[model samples]
Structures are given as C-alpha cells and as structure tokens.
Target chain A: MSQNVEPFKGLKKLNRKLAKLHHILKRDINISTVSTPTNNLVLCNSGLVNGLTEDQVFEHFSKHGEISNITMLPGKSCCFVSFSKKDSATSAYECFNGKLNISQNNRPVYLSFVEEVPKPSIEVIWNELPPGLLVFKNFISTEEELNLLKLIDFNHEQCGLLKHRLVKHFGFEFRYDINNVDKNQPLDQSVPTETDFLWLKLAQIQPEFKGFKPDQLTVNHYAPGQGIPHHIDTHSAFEDPIICLSLGSSIVMEFKKDGTHTCVLLPQRSLLVMSGESRYDWTHGIVPRKFDIIKTKLGGYTCLKRTTRVSFTFRKVLSTGKCECFYRSKCDSFLNCNIEEKMAVQLEKMHVHKVYDNIANHFSNTRHKPWPNVMDFVQSFDSGDFLVDVGCGNGKYLSNNTHTFEIGCDRSANLIEICRNRKFEAFLTDCLSIPIRDNCIDGVISIAVIHHLANESRRLQAIQEIVRILKKGGKALIYVWAHEQVKNKQKSSYIMQDRKNRKGTKEMNGQCLTSAQQVSLDSGNITLPVHSNRSNFQADDLLVPWKLKGDEEENESVFLRFYHVFKEHELEELCLKVENVRILKSYYDQGNWCVLFQKM
Target chain B: MKLLTHNVLTSKCIRGVTVGYPLLIKATNVKVSEVEFKPDFVAKVLPKIEWDVLANAAESLGHWQNLPKELPNNYENDTDFLKKIHRVLLEVEVIQGELICPESGRKFPITNGIANMLLNEDEV
Candidate 1:
C-alpha cells in the first residue's frame, strides 16, 4: 500500500510523521515531570544551554519572571526551562545574548550577554515583564551576503553636523541615505536575503530584532586620520540602539559618557549592541588616526594592522518622510524615489572632502606662474596640515611640496619608498583605511585615486577619510578620470596587450599597441581584462585601444569600449551629495573631471 | 571669480551668446579684505574654479600684481598674494552691477552682490 501511494499521499504521510515526532517529545517531557506549573511552556529540544550551576542559571531564568519547572537529562543533554509567557522567554533571550557565540550544535555557551534592556513602553516583556533593551549578533551571511554587499555601494550619503538640528538645541550629526529612506521594504534595506539563515537563528534567540526591520545599511570605511565626528542620530527618523557590525578593521567606537569618554574598540566581525542610555543619551564617533594600536598604555590588544575595511551600520529608521526628502533631492534620478531620498540626504551629510577642488585651483592665477599658483595652494594649507595623495603613485606631488610637515600616504609602499628616496616622506597606505587623526588636517588633495578602487565602498571610505582629517572650514581637492580618461585607459589596455603578444600591430617608439588576445568574465558577465602594463602594456606604448574582456572583442571584430564617463549633470549631483563639502567647482576638460570643495 | 559664479556663467548657457563661458574679467573696480587667512578655507575654494579663468580674473583685477606668470619654484613668500587672491576669490563683494558674457554679450547682472542668471523657462 505504501509502495502504491501517490506523491501527494507520500508527502502527507511525511508531515504526519513529523507531527508525531513533536508529540512524542512533548509526552516524554510531561511524563518525566509531575504537576507542571500553570505558567510553564517548553522551549525547543536539541537547542538548549549545556552546563551551569542551578543558582547561577536560575538567576537568569528568574529575572525573566520565574522558571516554573526545569527538566534535565543526560544523553538527552537538552534541558527544558519552562517560562510563563512564550514571548517573554523569547524576548529575554534576544535582549541578553544578541552577540553571544553559538557552537557547532547551534547552542550558545559563552554567556556573551547584555543586561537591562531599556524599556520604552510597558507592553514588551519577558513573560509578564518587558526588558528595556534588545541584543543580537552575526546576522550577516559570512560567505554570500557579505561578499555581495562589498560589490554594491554601501556609502551613507548624508554625513555632517546637522545645521538644522543645531537650531533645535541638540548637538546632532547624522549620516543618512541620499535616496528616499522609506521607499523600500525595511527588511530589504537591512537584510537583502532571507536565505542568510543565520538571521533566522538570531531571531529565534532574540525576538526584539524580529519586529524591527532595517531599511538601510551604512558602511563606515575609515583609515588613519579619518573618522566621523561626535554626533547623535536623528531621533525623529530612527529610535535607539543603533546596531553596528564591525568588519575587516578595528576602531574605537567612542561614546561620551557623562563628561568622560567611554570608548570601545569594535573588533573585526564583532557586533556592538547599543541603545537607551548608551544610544539616545550619548554621542558616538570614531577618532581619525592610522592603525588602531591597543598598547599597554591603552590597555587592550596590540597594534592591529590597518586593512581595507567595511562596516555595516544598521538601524531602524522611524521617520520615513524625512528620509524620502533627503534622498530624492540628492540623487540624479528620482527613480526609486523612496530609497534614493534617504541615501541622498545621508551622503550629502556624510563627511566627503572635495580633493579635486583644491587641485583645480592650485593654478587659478593666470598672471602668476603655475609655480605661484601651486605655492598659493600649498601655502593656503596650514603648518600641521595632514595631506594625503590617494594614488600618490611615486609621490610626485609630495616631491614637489614646499611644506614639510604633511603626511604623504599611498597604497603602494614601493611608490612611497621612492618618495622617501627623494627625501619626501610617504607611507604605504590604502584609501579605504587612511591612517590619520580626526579633524587634524587643514587640507587634503587626491589625484586619480577614486577610479583605482575596484568598488564603491572603497571609494566612499576614501572620501570619508579625507573628510575626517580636515578641520572645520578645511579644504579638499579631487581630480578624477572623467569617464573619458578611464575609457581611454580601457582602449589602451587592449591595444598594448595585443601588441605585446606580437600577433597584432607593429611596435611604435619602442612600445606596442594592439587588441587583447584573451577574454575574462566576472560573476557571469564579461569583464575587460585589466592591463597591468607590466604584463600587457609597456611603458612606451601607454596609449592604445583596449577592450574590457580579454580576447573576445578582437576575435569578434568589436571595438573595445571605455565605460567610466560621467555626464556633467551626473557629476554635479554626485558632488552635491557630499555633506559639509560644498561643491565649489566642477571642470570638464582633457578627458578628466576636476572638482573642488570646502568643509562648512 | 567664485567657482559658483564660473559654473553658472558658462558660454553656452547665455542665450544670444556664443562662446568663452567663464568670462575673462576686466575689472574697473577692485577691493581686497584683510581677513584672517585660513588655509583650509582657501583649499576648499580651489576646486570650484577654473585655474585659467581665475588666473585671468586675478590678472584683470590687478590681484596678480605680485604673483608669478606660472607656478613658482617655491611658494613660501606668496602669502600676501594668496591673501589678495583669496579676497578676490571669496570675500570681495560685487554688490551692484552685471557680468557681461564675453562671447554672447548677454548680461548676467549681479544684484545684491549675487548674480541672477536664471534661464528662461524654455531655456533650461
């Protein structure tokens, strides 16, 4: 009869068996204990705490009200601590162990817990009592979700001291969305996919984060001398306990406790669960500096090497309307108006320096020699000005410096060493994690660095770092490869690669330029092979037509296309989103876009 | 010659104008303020301007009287010139009058020291 059963019937039978299994578990627990209390309810099996004293453990249980009964069995290993209300039990677990570590069996053992969750209302409870705080950790998918987030732009557009809020008596600064905050589903903004599975586990442990969904995520990318200033989140937009997930690098997430500073180092991949008195009552910020070294004097871990880091700052935005206005007014297109508005406002308010502006005006005086213009630009900087040349390449700008005190940092140590060889000090550094002091520099200048970063998070972080160093009314200058400049490079990559193989064009002036001989793909899409110049293009033949893909275009008789051009309006809008860094000038010429800005 | 002004006074934007956006100013009146020199502030103003346009404007305003014809070998002694340049670029108020586009001959008036260059509804 079982063999003759249809697929539907077979499925039904499986469901029945599952139901019977649950009943058996319930019956076994019931038979073991006598006179179960009226308030008792069983937690799930197989997923229970392993070991603890009855007194110590009971304290945790009683705090959530009272543990009516406890059933423990060896081999069965799992013990049931019955609670008065299912919701109360769930909330208690979530509030206390949000950042707790779980074992291979999905059971928590380390007691990484938070206490005294701030209660805003009397309705929420552990059994009949609602805790004042909520806690959670590792809600992100390590392999899939994190990798995906890196590819996408996670910059908070709005980052600046709120002039509007200052008028209201609170010293508040915000990094909000440039696009509308309310347009997308909250879960979509915070957790892009449900398959993360880890979040489900966290939700099971802490039910507080279950109802509150995050609609946006801000990735704070900092390097030395780069940090967000002391600021309060918009109370009208989001409620307390901003959940911050630190990754890649470490930083001091400082909180102003009373008149003293209570700082905590947000270690890599760690979650900082904060709210109530810690959230609404205090200000938080990262102090700009190079490597976060926890020395004996500092009383923490040793010096942690600075790396390209990205932090997912998640918070539930309460006011949807405020977010929408800030985003739509900033983005180029009003499409996705809801999400775009919040993003725009956030980005504009965020700390973004205009490195192009200072560079552009470095030669603004027509009558003066270019040297004088450079000098004026240089002298315009302060004695202790902290300047960074993002793609300092060979530190050409630093080599030409009249000022001696500024720091010159680059991603390539070889290039920095060359600067050092030239008696111009430079260091090996990445734009994503600039090593400098917060609000310490008077000016920053970056030339052709934004394009070098492979993704948006790196680009935004680099910009933020520059902003972090400059004092109020400080200056920033940025020179970008106008979409045209990058396109030209793309074209040249192909021609140089093709010529190097000696299968395409003749060498000219001791250099070769030809189409690519290979094709490459990234995430299923065809990508133009990057010409490292060492392997593909030579020093002599710097200008050549190149395709994004390796050899596919040459074989298909397709002309390699350059893909980084920005229309004037789009560039203008991009500049406007940088808060405090007001757009002063945008120039389009010579296959590049130059922009200037100042901190307000 | 603020970058903000330079951006709005482009040659093509002037209806009835031809070219040479970023006007080449021939200043009849000039003023310099002795404001506290803020290097960061000056650095912030750098990007919004066209170097060549500002150079020409500085020359026309006589602010380049002390500056070099090109970038100097060393810029240390150029503080006075820089301050003058800063005053010209950021502080000098041009409260009354108009900026005539050199190419288009279209007048973009400076009323209350702010240029009014709003295009006709159809010209956006």
Candidate 2:
C-alpha cells in the first residue's frame, strides 16, 4: 500500500511538470498543443541548449519511422521533430511522452504533439563559416602532432590550473578573470622548439601562416566533457592573427555573435587562423558534450562522439601600447578606460556635458549668485595676478575684480560663449586637463565643479591639475556637494531650497533608483546601483536629476547629471594625495565640503 | 585661447605623441584688447612663458608687432619690452583658430576664444 501511494505521488509531480511545459510551449513559441495526433512532435527538455544535441533527438525519433526534418532551436529547451507520416510521429510521441529518460541529464523527456514546427529564426547555412575564419586540414603530419603533444609534458609543467581543462602556458599566463594578460610578467618558458617544423610545413601549404610568429602558446588538453567558455580574445592583449593547431581529434567549435550562430568542424591536424572580424568580434567556444552533430560529406547529419582533443593555440602579445580596432564597441583597447571608467565617462557625457550644453542658457541664468568665500578667494589675488576659475559657469566671477587678470574655463562651450559675449576672458576646457600653463596662475577657484566628476580618480585628477597650474604659494579654493545635508541640526541650503523638487513628479519607488545593473569589473562583475533624489545619501556615485524649467509649469524637462557627492574627509583625503599642496582650510558650508589649499 | 594658455598646452595626452609641446597656432579670427599694462606681473609671468612659442603664436595670428623672438637679458626693467610681451601674451587672443599638435598634427579648435582640446575616445 505504501509503494502504491509513492507511485501516485510521483505521477502527480510528473503531471504538474508536464502541464507547466505545455503552458511554456504554448505561450512562448506559440506552438499550440493538440490532443489529436499530428505529423510533428515537439520534444520538451531535448534541445541543443538543454543538454541534448540534435543528433541524439534524431537518432531516437528516426527509430520509429523516416524523419523529414528536425529543428532544434539554439539556446532553447524544446526541439521539433516532424515525420513523413503522422502515425510515425504519434507512435514516437506516445513512447517518449513522460516515459523517455534522457541518459545525459537523467531528466524525464516530455513530448507533445504540436500543429507545426516553429521556423528557425536564423537561416540555415551549414556550409558557411564566419568570415575571417580559415581552417587548413592536414597542415601537420601525424608525427608532428605527437611530437608537439609530447613537448607539453603534463607531469613537468603546471597543468590543470583551471577546473574545466588542463592547460599549460608559455610566454605569458592568460588571466581568465580579466580576460587579459599582464604583459610585464613573462614566463621563463617559451614556445616548444619542436613546433618550429610547422613553420616550414605551413610555408608549403597555407601562405597565411608564412610569416606569422607567436610569442605566447597555450597547450590546451580538453577531455570529452571539457570546454572553454565563449569569448573573444582581448583585442588589446594580442595582435591580429590568433592561430590554433588542433591535434589528436576533431570537434565542432561553436562561433556566435549577435544572433547568428555557426559551428565549424575543426578536423584533426587542422590549422585554424582567426583574424579581423572573426578574431576581434565573434566569440568562439567548444560546447562541452560527448557527441556533436556533424555534417557529412553527402550533406547528411550524423553524430561524431568527441575524443581526447588537444590544441596548441599560438598568439603574439600586442607590444603596441594601444589597439585601434575598427570594432570600437567590442574592442578592449578602445574600452581602455575600464568598465568603471567607461561608465564614468558615459555617465558624464550623457548626464553632465550634454545636459549642461542643452541647458546652458537656463543654467547660466540660475547660477548668477557667486558664493562669498569664492568671491573673497578671487579678490585675494594681487593686482595684475593671473587667476583662473576652472568650470566658471557663465563666468560669474570672471570680471568680479578688475585689479587682477582673471580667465574662466568650462567644459561647456555655450557657457564659454556667454562669457565671450560679455567681453570676459574664458575658454572651453575640461577640468581634468586645464589646457593652461603650469605654475603660472596666482590663484584658482574651482567652485562646485569637482563633484560633477563621476569617479574618485577623476575628481582627484581635477584637483591635481589645479595644483599643477597654480604657481608656488598660489591658493586654490574647491567646493563639492556634501553627503550630509543637515549637520548639527542645521539644514543646508540645498535641502532648504529643495521645496519644489520635494514632490517628485514621477512616483518612483524608493528602491527604483537602486536598480542592480551588473557592471563588468576587472575583479569580476558588480551591480552598480542607480540612486534617486533621496534626502539620505546611499551611494557616492549617482545620477542627480535636474528638471530644466520651460516657459510653462508643465513644460519641465528632466535631465540627469552624474554626481559624486563627497562624504566627510573624502575631499580632504583626495587633496592630501597632491604632494605639493597644503590644506589651508577645510570646512563644511551650506551642504558643501569647501577646501582652501595652497601650492607649496 | 590666449597666447599665455598656449605656452604650456601640449598634445602629449594623445597616444604615441611624445613632444606635443609648442603647438603651432593658425588663427582665422584674432583679437587684441587693451589690457592694464602691469610690468611687474608680465615680468613674473615671462619666466614661465615659452618665449619662442609666444612669438610664433603671435606671428601665426598676424599680431606679432615687433616683439622679440627671445626673452631679452635682464629685460624685466625694460617697460617697452615688458609691454610688448604683455600685448603678445595676454592682449592678442585666437578667437577662431586651431592649435595643431606638433607631433600628431591633431587640431584643437578655438571657437569664440575657447580652445577645445578634448580628445576623442579612440585617441585616448
């Protein structure tokens, strides 16, 4: 009786899962499940992405009758197999529905009769390999393959550094974490001397490898179940051509980019050279499976079980300082400003520079009032002394004192234009590089500027540039927005003057701003959270929305400006990093960390 | 962009450009305004100024009015020399021009007296 109940419970669970699968198929792919028998059968849990390769499904389904075609969606868990006769399809579906247990995953295969097979999103081009991907079969003799394999010396070399496969590196160790190498750290070992014979052989067969020489060689020993994750070789890390010589076995290496996926068969003793688009843009990886669906010479598909495969991947480390690959978005060298820096620049360009450019006229009108402390700093300079107000919006402080020759520079060209029209001396320049003579200016006032910088290093760099431009004994004043709006029970003007924005126009959830967008960091990935305009500071880096008011009350347009609001001691610590500067005064005034430093 | 700012500006920030200093000026619009002639300030700034760069920059803008090619020996007391240097360095400005990087030939444009020395993403 206990055994009978156990079977009933198991049947109930299977029935529930089958219902879920039915709903998913109907909702996602629009393949309606029909109770009546049809010529087509959709096998759930059996697909290229779902542990089952295409040949496995064909082999099982074709056993019932002749199969017209089998369609397996890439990166999906359902495969459609249609038979020439409806009886064959029904019989196969009857036999496999909740009965066939997949040997690979040990999961029960669910099958349901469907109206028709969903067409492949990408057209099938079996003969075509991705452009720039060249494979030369029989490039090396069997003897050369054995000799190169022997030189690897698993027992003598550092093998199995990674869990997925056994790999040995020569010249430089490829860092999987950063997807790049520390070019400075060269290994004592070099490419095996025995493989030099391939150069003479390549000259006879493939002229593409005629003049190529590689400094870095990674000998990868992949077992049947081992594979490398899909990735493009770091564009800045290596030169154009990446050559790999396969030995001992043949396997289908998957190539994918955007939405197109192609698998190329790298036969045993083949030399594969990936350059240009194939090398820099498309990602290539081997699917870790025992069997691969291979195309036969007769244009028919068959299963080729994977064997012990080994490859000698050769690459020349890019000695050139930078890579100017045409694939700008995909190139690592182009993204030389690591992801954080990229995000910073992107955030600034969209939120800061472009926003200020669009709202320059309104921004200048709202920014006429000069802080008393900054005014006093500008006036403190001696008559005829050269003073620069970095990021002087609208040049409010440019003509404050006629005794000294003051120049205003800002990142915004429109603001600079306004200053020019006012007959004041101003220039367009980013605070990161002042574009001014070093050690020439007697005084510098950078009020409410550094906070616009998106990151710590950039903000620090701006301050350092200020120090670089100031003459010895020259004083500079910097002010950044403070994290704490209310200190000592006294509310700052930023909070006191926030009466209009208190009622946010859009009812954003308190947690909405903290959307966890995964940011690829050198250390790995981190979720860089976005922040809303909240009273309490939860993050240092955030987008502060500024509503550009138009003529009408409802005509307000919002623009986000990136801000790195300073915490206590953050401003002082950054200034201390500049070796030549002495902090004259550091204080909090009106929700801002104001610092007066002199170049010593 | 004033000749004073041009004195220290360099395009070394661009990749592969080493000696981007002493940028050559090519001005379409040049303006010279009457600045308060302060001989003492000009004398102090003269030491920091790249004199050859200043002279060439003024010449390129077609505002080089009998200014000396080199800083005169002990010329701080010479009010005439100081006044000439002051006019070239501070008074004459490149309103609409380009500051061409000597090494890379990359141009930084000066529009409305503002020189945009910003490098593109690929350049950096």
lDDT of each: 0.44, 0.77
Q: Interface RMSD for every prediction, one decimal?
A: 18.4, 2.6
Among incorrect, acceptable, medium and high, the docking class of model 2 is acceptable
Top of the candidates by lDDT:
2
lDDT of 1 at A595: 68
Assess each model's interface with DockQ, reporting 2 decimals per model.
0.01, 0.25
In angstroms, the error of model 1 at A537 is 17
Candidate 1, superposed: residue stretches over 4 Å from native: A1-376, A382-384, A485-518, A521-526, A529-566, A569-572, B1-124
Query: Tens digits of per-residue lDDT for model 1 on B6-121?
Result: 32234353345445466544334444434446554555444433567656666655555565555443334556655655665555544445566676566655433333443442
TM-score for all models, in order of appearance = 0.26, 0.49
Clashing pairs in 2: A513-A530
Error at A92, model 2, angstroms: 3.7
**lDDT score of residue B91 within candidate 1:** 50
Shift of residue B101 alpha carbon in model 2, Å: 31
lDDT of 1 by residue, A1-600 (tens): 122212332446544543553455557543222222333323323322444322333444455654444443433423444454655455445433212223224333211111112122221111111122233334443664466445444344333222211100011212231111333233223344432443455467767656545545555555444666676554444654567766566665666634455545565665665555555555677655555433223221234445555566566566533322222322122321122333322222221112222222221121122223333455566443445555555555664444323446554434544555555444444465443445545667776566444333445656776776577887777765543222222333323343543342212212312333434332232233333332333111111222223345564321222222333344455546666778676765444466667778
Fnat of candidate 1, please? 0.00
